[model samples]
Target chain A: MSDKPKILILDDEEDLLATYKDLLTNLPSKPEIYTTTNGARAVAMLDAEQFSLLITDLHMPEIDGFQVLAIVRRRFPELKILAISSVLEEQYRARAYSLGVDMCWQKPGTENEIKMFFDCIESLLEERPSEGFRGIQNKSLVDLIQLECICRNSTTLKVISGGIEGKIYILDGEIIDAEFGNLTGDIAFKKLISLKKGSFEYLPAVTERERKIFSSTDGLLLDAAQTIDETTAEDKSEVPDASETGDRTALVKPVIAMSKIDGVDFILIGELKSPQPSDSWGVDDSKNLHKWISNTVQLWRSFGDKFLCGELKDIFLYGHHCKVVLKTKENKLLCAGFKATVNNETIPNLMKDVIALWV
Target chain B: MGLTKAKKDQSIKLIITKPGSFTVDANGNILSSTLPLSVPDKFIEIIIHNVLETFLTARASGLIFEEVIIQFIGLKIVAREMRGGALIHLTPLKP
Candidate 1:
C-alpha cells in the first residue's frame, strides 16, 4: 500500500524491539518498521498489513518463533523471513530453517554481527519488489541442481512442496549430502529429486553434515532417474522387474573389450563412487579388487593433493609375474591384468588406446 | 620436478622413468630409499602402509595379487609384496 518497504520485528523484549526498530528505520531505503513485543501481536499486525520482511526471535513465551514461523511461512510464503536466537544452538536454528525461515542466524552481538544483520535487512528490503529470488518457483529441483552443478557452486538447496521440505547440499558440483526429515544421504536425495513440484531456495554454503552420498551429481541424478522409473513401473506391472542390466551392460562393454585383448588376463569394471564392482571377468575376486581400488583411490587422492599432481586418473602395477593397469573414467573404473609374457613396451600404448576408447 | 606429458600426445609410453624407490619391512619401517631428501619419509611411510594394508585386506578376501602399479596424472607408484616386505617405486612420467 505504501512506497516504503515494511518490515515486522517480533521479540519478547520491548527494549530489543525498540533498538532494532531504531536501527532499521535509519536504513537507506527508510523502510517502515513495525515492532511488537508479543509474537501473537506481531502475527496479527502482519495479517492486517503487508510486510516486506519478518524478523522473529526464536525464544518466546506462548507463541514461539518456531510456531510463528510455521504459521507465517504457510500463510505468507512470499514474505522474506529471518529467524534469530540468542540461545544459539544448532537444533533451534535447524528447526527454524526446516520451517522455511529464509535466513536464520544467532542474534547479533558484536559490531560486525550487527553490521551484517543490518546489511542482510537492507538487501532483503532492496529485493522486496524484485522477483529474482523471493522464491524459485515452477522450475524443478533437477533444473536448479543442474544449473548449480554446472557452475560448480557450493550451496545448499532447500526445496518446499506440498508443505514437505528437504535440503540437498552440493559442494564443488558434487552432491555430498541431503536431508529430508529422518532420511539422509542417497535415500534423502532420491526422495527429494522425485518431488515433482516445489519452490526451491539455495544458500551459498555447504552443510556441516558428514558426507553421506559419494556419487557424482551426474551419477546421483542418473540413479535417481532410474529409481523414479523403477517406481513408476512398479505400479504398471504386478511383478516389477527393476534391474540395472541395461545400464550395467553399457558400463561393462569397454571393460569386456579390454579383457579381450591379447595376453589380458581379466578386466574389472566398477563405479568409482560405489563400493561394488559393476562387472568383471576372469578375475578371481572382482569385489575385493573394487574394495582395494576404493581404498587406494582415497589414498591416491591425498597423494595427489600433497604432490599437486592433480587427480588420479589411473594406476599401473608391475610385478615379475603380471602387469596390472587401472584407469578411471567419469564415475567408474577399469582394472585390467595382463600376463607377464605381454610386451612391456607395447602395453602402455595399447592400454592408452583402450582407455581413450573407453570414455 | 615432475615429468608431465602434454595432452596432445596420443599414446601413453610405458617407458616412464622411475625417479625414486623405497623398501619397507614387515614392521612397516623403511628399509631403504632412493628418493630425494626433500621427499619426506613420512609420506613414504604412509604410502607404503596404505598399500600394504589394502593388499593384505584384499588378500584376506580371497583376491590374490602380487604387484600393484598406480598411475596418477604424471605420477606413478608401483609396489610389490615380497616376503613380508614391500618394494615401492615412485615414477614421475608425462604419460
Candidate 2:
C-alpha cells in the first residue's frame, strides 16, 4: 500500500538477495524491494503483486531464469526484465538479447556502480527504442551502413524501390563490394548512395570471396557521406539533365584496405590471462596451446635479432570454434581469436593491420 | 553392366574425381562438385578458391609448390595444384 514503486529481485543465493535488497533501498528513488530465492516463488510474487521491474539471475536450480523470463514476457509484455549472472558466455548473452531481455548485467561492484545500474533499469522502463536493428525510417543509408561496420556485423543489405534493386555486401563489418546493374565497387556504391528513396532489408549472410576492390570501410562510408552532402547542397532548379550529368566527375581517394574480420570473438594484445572455465576455448586445450605458443616464439627468433622482425606473423591453430593468429611487433604479441565461420582470405590482412597498430 | 551401375551411382552422389573432389572456375564460381548438394555450391567454391589462392601466390613468388594443408577442428582440407586449377580434397576428421 506504500506509494513507492516495487522491484522484484530473484537469485539462488540468500547473500546476493540481501545485497541487492540493501542496495535498492538506499537509491534516491527509494524503490520498495522484494527478494525471492526460488524462481517459482518469484512467479507467485509476480502473480500476486504489481511490480515495476524484475531482475533475475539466469542460472538457478528450480525453474531456471530463461523460463521465468519466458513466462514474464508472455504474461507481462510491458514489464522490463534484466538477466544477471556470473558466468555469461557470448552465445548465452546473444540468446538473452534474442529473447527480449532489456539488458544483461554481469556483476555489481561498489555502491556507485549499483546506483548506476538502477539508473539503466529506470531508463529501460521509460521505454526507448535503443536496442537491435529497427526498420529504416528517418535514417540515412550512409549512417546505417556505417553503424553496421562499426558493430562488425556480417550482413548483406538489399535496397529495392521503383523497380531498381541493388545488393551491398558487408562481411566482418567492412563494405567489401557492391553490385547494381553492371556496375561494381565504387561506381555501384556511389549509385546506391545516390538513391532518393528505397526500402532496405539487411540479411546476415556468411560470405567467402576475394574482395575485388580495396578501400577501408571508413573511407567508403566517408565517400558516401560526402556524395550525399554534395547532392543535398545542389539547388533542385539548377539540377543538370540526365544526359549531361557526368557520374565519374567526383572521385574518392582510396586507401589500402585491411582484411575482413567477421567472427573474431576477442583480440588479446598481450599475454593470455587465466581464462575462465566458461570460455568456449582456452585452458582446456593447454598442451596444444603451449606447443603453438612455443612455435610462435621460435618462428620469431628465426627471423634473427637484427632483422627487426616487426612484420613477423604466424597462424598458431585454426580450429572450429577457436583460431590463434599471432603477430609480433617489437616485443609485443597480438593474438586474434577467430570463429570458424570467418573467411580465411582475411587472415593475412588482419595480421598486417594488427601489427601496424602495435608498431 | 558395370558401366551402367557406375553411371547410376554417380547420379545419386557424383564422384567425378573422388568422393570429396570439387572444381571452381577462375572467378571462384562452382563449375562442378562431387560433394552433396546440401553443401551450397557458392560456399564451397569461394572457400576452395580462397584457400588455394594462398598456395598459388606462393608459387608465383618462386616458392616450390608441393601441397598446402589446412586442418580445422572437425575437417581437414588438402589442396594441390593440378593442370591449371587446384584439386581440393575435404576429409571429415571428427563427427
Candidate 3:
C-alpha cells in the first residue's frame, strides 16, 4: 500500500476540479488524488475506495453538495468533508455545518482564495483523527454522531453527563440502535443527542446488531433538530427573562401605556374578525397586523372544532425577528409583539392588565 | 351536485396536531396527522401540547378564531381549529 494519504475532489467544473487536483498533488505530502465531475459518481468512488479526505463543491446539478454531505455523513463518518461553495449564503453555510462538514470555503476563484484553500486542506490533513477515543470538545453530541456517520466509523459512542450514562450503537456508519434506560431506537438516540454537557468516548465497533430504525441519517438529524427546536420553544415559556426585573411595581398603567413591555415591541388591539373586516381595527397601516391576526384565527377555526367559542384565549407565536403573544377579550383581540427574551411568566399578567384597562 | 377531487400524491410526509389530553375523551389526543409511523411520539407530543395550550388559552380568553400561521427560521406552521380538535401543518422552508 502507498504511504501517501488518498484525497478525493468533486466539482462540476472540469477546469476547477483539475486545478484543485493539481494543487493537492504538488503538496509535500504527495497525496494520491482523484477527481469526479458527478456527485453520484464521487459517492460511488467513495464506497469503492478508501479516501483520507473529501473536498466537494456545493452547487452541483444532479446530486448537490448537501446531498453528498448527508450521504457521506451517514455512510462514511470517518471521512472528513470540506465544502466549497461560490454562493456563500449564511443559510447554506449553517446547513452544511449542521450536516457535519469540517469546513466551508467560499470559492472566489482568485489566487489568494486558492492559496488559503490549500493551506486549509493541509492543516486539516495534518490534524486528522488517528487514535482511539480522541477528545473532541465544544461540539454538540448530535453533531458528533453525525460526524461519526460521515466518517463511516463503526463505533460505540458512550456519553456521560450529570450522573447519567448512555450508549449509542453505530454499525457501518448507520446508527443501528441506541440505549438509555428502557428507551431504544430514535427515542434513545434523541436523548443522547440532547446532552449538552456530556463527555463522549468512541470505541471501535464490537458486536453486530440488527437495524432498529430505518430512517436515513439526514432524517435522523432533521428529527433531532426539530426536537431541540420544540424543546426550546417550550422552555422559553418557563424561563425567566432578564427584563422581568424592574417592571412589576407599577399597577395603574393605562391601556395604551401598557403596550411597551421591556422586550416587547408593537401592540395591536382589534376586534376578532376576518381579515378584510379586521382592516377597520387599523392598528398600523405599514403592516396589516390586524388582518394577519384575523387570518390566523380563521386558520385556527378550520381544524374541525365546530364548537369553537367566538373568542380565542391566547396565541403566542415565535418567528423570525419577533415573537407575539395574542389574547382575545369579549370583542377585542390583543396582539403584543415581543423579542425572544420576553419573560414567559409575565405575558399572562401583562395581557390581563392591558385587557382590564382597555376592554 | 356531488363534489369531486383531483388525483394527487398519496405519500404522507409530515404530521402536526394539538396534544391528546385536551381533546374530548376517546378521540385519542391526535388532533391531526399525516405521517405513517407513530414513532417520534415525544416530539409529536411536545409540539401538540404547545399548540393545544395556545388554542385553549385562546378559548378561555373568549377569542373566537379560525387559524394561526407561525413562521420560524426554516419552518412555517399553520394550525386550524376543527370540530373536536385542531389541524396543524408543518412545512420546512429550508434545510
Candidate 4:
C-alpha cells in the first residue's frame, strides 16, 4: 500500500545485511527493506508477504541461494530477483541465468553496479511481462560448491574470508583438504571440514584465466582427495577393527591395479611342497587337492572384476602341496618368497615391501 | 606293554615330498604352497602376506599390483639339505 517499493535481502552475513539495509534506507524513495541471515528464513518471509525485489547471497548454511532462486521462480514468479556475491565465476553466472535471475552484482568495486541493478528492477516492476530470460548472477562461492558437487569435481576451493583466505578441497563430496591461510591438506581438512556451522565471507570475482588454471590443477588434486575422503568415510562409518582397516586400506591399491591390468594378473605367495611317497595315500588324494586349488583360484578370479581394470584373461596358479601362485598377462615370474619373508615379520610388513616396488 | 607298543609301531608314517618355491608377481597374483621341496617356509609366508597385502594396499591407495606368486617346497631333511628359496614376480597393474 505504501508508495515505496518493498525489497527483501537474504544473506548469512550479519554485517552485509546491515550494510544493505543502511544502503537501501538512504535511497530517495525510502524503500521498505527486510533482511534475514538464511535462505530458509527468507523463503518463510516471502511466503508471508509480497515484495517487489528480492536480493540474496549465494552461500549460506542449510538452504543455499540457488535453491532460493529455484523456489522464487516456482512459487513467486512475479518477484524481481537480484543475486549478489563476492565470488562470481562463469559457471555460476550461467546457472543464475538459467534460473531466471534478473541482475547479478559482484560485491567488490561494484557500488554503482548495485545502483544500476535497482534501476533495472524499478523499470521491470513498472511493466511486468509473462516470461523473459533475466540476466545471470555472478558466480558465487555457493555456485562453485554446487558446480563441483554436480560434476563430482575435486579441487581446492579458495575463499577469502575476513582478511584471510581459506582453501578446502572436496573430493566426491568428502572434504579432504583445507587450509585457513597457513595450514593445508590433511591437517587443514581435519580442522575445518567439520566446522559447517560457521559463517564466513567470500570473494567471488576470480579472473577467467585463473579459474581455468584452477579447474585443471585442482581437478586432479580433487580426484585424489575424493579417493581419500571416500576411504576415510568408509573407515569411519564401518568402524572396522584396526587389523581389518589395515587390510581394507591395503587392498585399495591392489584392487585398483588389478582392475587396470590389461589381460591377466597373477600373484603367488608361500612355499611349495611336493607330496612325499608316504604322503600319497592314493590317486584320489591328488585329485582332491587339485579341486581345492581350482576352487581357490576361481574365488581369486572373481575378485578381479572389482579391480580398476575389471578385465582379466586368465590366471594360472601353481604351487607345491602347500604353495600358491598366480599369473597374469603382463609378465610371468615368482614374487616374494623365502628371502622376502625372512626379511619381514608380519604380513603387512612383507606387503609393504612388495608395494614399494610399484611406487 | 612290549607287545602293545610293537603293534602300534606298525602304522604307516606320512612324509611330504613335494618341492616348489613361493612366487608372486606385481599383478597381485599370489601362489603359495607347502608341497614343493625347494621352497622355504619363511619365503612362502612372505609371498602370501605380500600378495594379500598388495591387494589390500592397492585398494587403499587406488593403485594396482599386476601379479604376485608364491610356491612351497616340501622335502624331508635328515641333517641339512633344507635350504629353502622363493621366486617373486612383480609388475604394474596396467590397463
Candidate 5:
C-alpha cells in the first residue's frame, strides 16, 4: 500500500505546472501529483480518483476555479480545497470564503506562502471531523435579499426577477446601477447602488478598447447634433432652402453611420500552411485546430445582433502563411491580412481567436 | 517732375510689400493675379473659396499644412506658400 498522500494541482500556466511538479517531487514522501491546465478537466479527474488535497487557480479557460470549488463542495464534502488567484479583488476573496474554501493564496510573489498553505493542510488531515458540513441550500430571491442584509458585500447586485432585470450596486453590500432593462453609465450605476435587490448577476468586465470606442461614438454624435442646431439658428433669417439643409445633413451623416457599429470588436482569420519535412500535422493537431475554430464561431453566433454583420473570410492555409481580415459594417478595413509561418502558427491563431471573442 | 517721381516711388513700394498671389488656371499655367484684383470684396471672396476647397481636399487625403496665416498690406494682398502649394498669407483690402 502507498503510504504517501495524493495531491491535485490545476493551473493554466505551464511553467507553474513544472515548478509545482519539481517542488512536490522533492518532498519527503514524494506524494502522487496530478496536474491539469483547465478546471473542467480537473473536475473530471477528481470524479475518477481520490485526492487528499485540491489546489486550483481562480481564472482558467472554460470553467473558473471558483466554479470548480462550488462543484467539489457539492459532490465531495470531505475534500480539502485551496483557492489561488492572481487578482486580489475583494469580491473574489469574499466569494471564495462564502463558498467554504479552506484557504486562499495569491500568486506571483508568494512562494513561501504556498509552502505554509500545504503545512496547514497537512495538520488538518491528521484530525478528521466526524460530521461533514452540509452544502448551501438553493435560495429564492427573498432569501437572497435576506442574505444580503445579513452579510453585505460592498458591490453592485444586479438581479433578474421574474424575467425583469434590476441592478443594485452595493457599497459594502449596499445597492448601487439599478434599472429595469439594459441601463448603463453613471446615472444607471448610481441608481443600482441604492437598490434592495431580488437576486443579482455581476456584469463581466469590459476591455479598455471597448470602453474607448463607446465613449468616442457618444462624443461624435453629440458634436454632430450641436453642429446641426447651430447651422439652423444661423440660417433663421434666410429663406429655408432644401439644398442647404441637405448639405448640412451630409456633414452629420458620417458620424451617425460610424456609431452604429462597435469598432472595438475584431474578427478571427485562420490560416493553414503546408507542412515542412520536419513538421508534423498529425490527426491530434488537426482535430484540436478544428475544435478551436468551431468553438470560436459558435460564440460569435450567440451574439448575432451585436456582431451579425461581421464576416469571416475563408481560412487561408497554404505554404508558410494564413491570415484573417476584420472589417467594419461600413466596409472600412480595420486589420487586414495577418500571416504566420508554419513553424510559429500558435501565436497567430491565438491572436485571431482572441480578437474574434472580443468582437 | 518732383510730384510724379514721388508718386511712382510710392506705387513701387506698395507692389513690393504686397506680392501678387497666383493660382493654376484651366490650362495649368500659373495666373499672375486673380482677375478684377482692384475689387477687394470679390478678390477676397474668390481667394477664400479656392483656399477652402484646397484645404478640404487635402484634409480628406490625410495631409496637413504646417502654417496657415493671412497677412495684409495696404490695398494689396499676398499669401505665403506651404506644403501642397497652400497659400498662407493675405494682403489688406484695396479700397
Candidate 6:
C-alpha cells in the first residue's frame, strides 16, 4: 500500500476523465492523480503502479469498469474501488459490489448530483476503515477470466504460479488464445486457469495471437473445472468415488484427503457385513484385503479379551510386505496399509494423523 | 527397539511386563497357558486360528506379519514371532 493516497480515474470519454482529474486536485490530501480513457490501459497502469483508489466507469469501450474492478480487486487487496455508470441500473450496481466494488453511483448530471459525487469521492479518499474489508477477496483465476470476457475485454493476461507460466488472450469477452509451456488452445486454457494458485498481470493484446480456443468463456470454465475435478478425485484415490458415498462421506473425507501422503499406500473402511471395503483410498478392487482385515481384527479382539487386554482399541501389524494399522469402531474396521519404503518408526504417528479426524 | 546396556543399568527398578500369558503354534493351536483364562480352550483355539490363519494368509499374499501389537482399554497384547508359532504376552496399560 502506498503511504500517500493515489487515485486513478478510468472513463471512455476523455473530457469526463479530464474534469475528474482537475476536480480531484482540490482535495487537501494532494494525492497523485492518473487518468486513462482506455480500460485496458487503466488495468495495466493499476497492475504496474500501486494506486490506493480506482474510480471507473461501468459502461466503457474495449473493456468495461466491472472487468477492471474484478481484475484489480483481488490482485490489490488494500485498494478501494468506486464505480460510476451512465445507465445506473439496479442489477449493475449489485454486480459491481459482487465484483468487489466498494461504492457505485450514477454519473453526475445535475449540479447537485455533481457536487454530491465530488463530496463522496473526497470523503472516501480521506476515510480509512479500522475494521477489515467486507467483499470476497479470494476469487479464482477462472472467475477473473469469466468476468474479463463478460465485459468483452480485448486484453492479454500473463498468469504465473511457481515454475509454471501461462498466457491467456480474451478478445471481446471470448477466450481466443492461450499458451502454457508447449500446450496451446483450449487445452492450454484449461490447464492454465485450472492452476490452484497464481497471479495475473494485464498485457497489451497482440493483433496476431492466433485464435487457438474456440469455446466461449463459460464453456471453457466449465470444461476446466470438470477436468481439474476428475484429476483431483483420482489423485485422492477413492475407489467408489467419495462424492457418491453419501452416508459414509463425512468419515470417508479425511481418509480420502490423506491418501498417498506420508507413504500411506491404501486406506480402507471395512464393514464387517460387506465382503468388499465400504470406502477405500488407493485400494484396488480386492476382496481378500478386506477379509484379511476382518480376520485380523477378530483374532486381535479374541486375544485382547482372553488375555485380559480388555476392550480392543487398535492393532498394528508390522511385516516384511507392508505395515497395517487397524482401528475397530463399532462394526467398522478403519484400516490403513503403508508402503514398505516408509520408516517403521514413523508409521504409528502417521497412521494416527491420517485416521484422527473422524476415526 | 531395544535398550542399551547403559539404559539397562540406569533402569534399576524391577519391571514386571507379564501379568499373564499364553502361547499359540503356527497353526494357531494353544501350546501352553500360564494365566488361567476364563474362556475355554475351544474359544481360545478359535480366536488363535481366526487371527493367525489370517496372518498366514496375508503372508502368502506378500504381507508377512513379523510382530503385531494389539492395544485395549486396560491391557495390551504384544505378539512376536517365535519359530513358526507366536509368543503372546499380556500386560496392563499404564494410564
Candidate achieving the largest lDDT: 1
Model 5, range A1-359, lDDT digits (tens) per residue? 23467678889998998888777755665676767776765765565456777888888877788888877765555567778888868898889878767777776467677687556656645444332112322433334433554575544445543234565443333333334466654444323323222234555322221121222323433443455456457667464554666554333222122211222111222322212111111111323333333432333222222212122232221122233222232122222223333223453454354344324
CA shift of A42, model 4, Å: 0.8
The better-scoring model by DockQ among 1 and 5 is 1
Task: Provide DockQ values for all models, in the order shown.
Answer: 0.22, 0.01, 0.02, 0.02, 0.01, 0.27
Off by over 4 Å in 4: A108-111, A114-359, B1-95
lDDT (Cα, tens digit) per residue for candidate 3, span A15-47: 987777878998778888877777766775675
* Candidate 5 chain A: worst-modelled 10 consecutive residues by lDDT: A274-283
lDDT of 6 at A300: 66
Could you tell me the fnat of model 1? 0.48
Number of clashing residue pairs in every model? 7, 0, 46, 131, 29, 2
User: Could you tell me how far off, in angstroms, the CA of residue A267 lies in candidate 6 after the best superposition?
Assistant: 1.3
Compute the lDDT of residue A13 as modeled in candidate 6: 90
In candidate 6, chain A reaches a TM of 0.38
In terms of docking quality, how is candidate 5 classified? incorrect
lDDT of candidate 4 over B6-70, digit per residue (tens): 54333312232233333444443444533455434543453344345534443343322233332
Candidate 2 residue runs with Cα over 4 Å from true position: A110-112, A125-359, B1-95
Question: What residue runs in model 1 are displaced by over 4 Å at the alpha carbon?
Answer: A1-252, A283-285, A319-322, B1-18, B61-66, B93-95
Please give the TM-score that candidate 6 achieves against the real structure: 0.38
Identify the CAPRI category of the predicted complex in candidate 3.
incorrect
lDDT tens string, model 2, A241-335?
44455532222111111112344434444433222211121122333343344344443344222222122234343444445465554454455
Cα lDDT tens digits for candidate 1, A1-359: 23689888889998998899889999999988767666655665565456789999999998888888887886666688998989868888788888878788788999999999899889877873432223565555676888889998889988765457789988888788999988998999999887655466777676576899888788887887787688667656744333633333343356555644667766677887686887765554466678777776767767666655545776666656667677775567777777777876777876876676466
lDDT of 4 by residue, A1-359 (tens): 24577788999888978987987776666777777776765765665456778988876778888999987766665577888778989888888877767777666456677787656656655554332212212333343555676776655565432224476666654344456757765555433433222223333322221221134334644554565577568768776564655654453433233312222122232212312211111122332333333343444333332222233333322222111223222222222222221212243343344444333
Provide i-RMS per model in Å: 6.8, 18.2, 13.7, 17.8, 26.8, 8.9
Model 2 clash count equals: 0
Candidates in order, TM-scores: namely 0.38, 0.29, 0.33, 0.28, 0.30, 0.38
For candidate 2, give the DockQ. Answer: 0.01
Of the pair 3 and 5, which is ahead by DockQ?
3
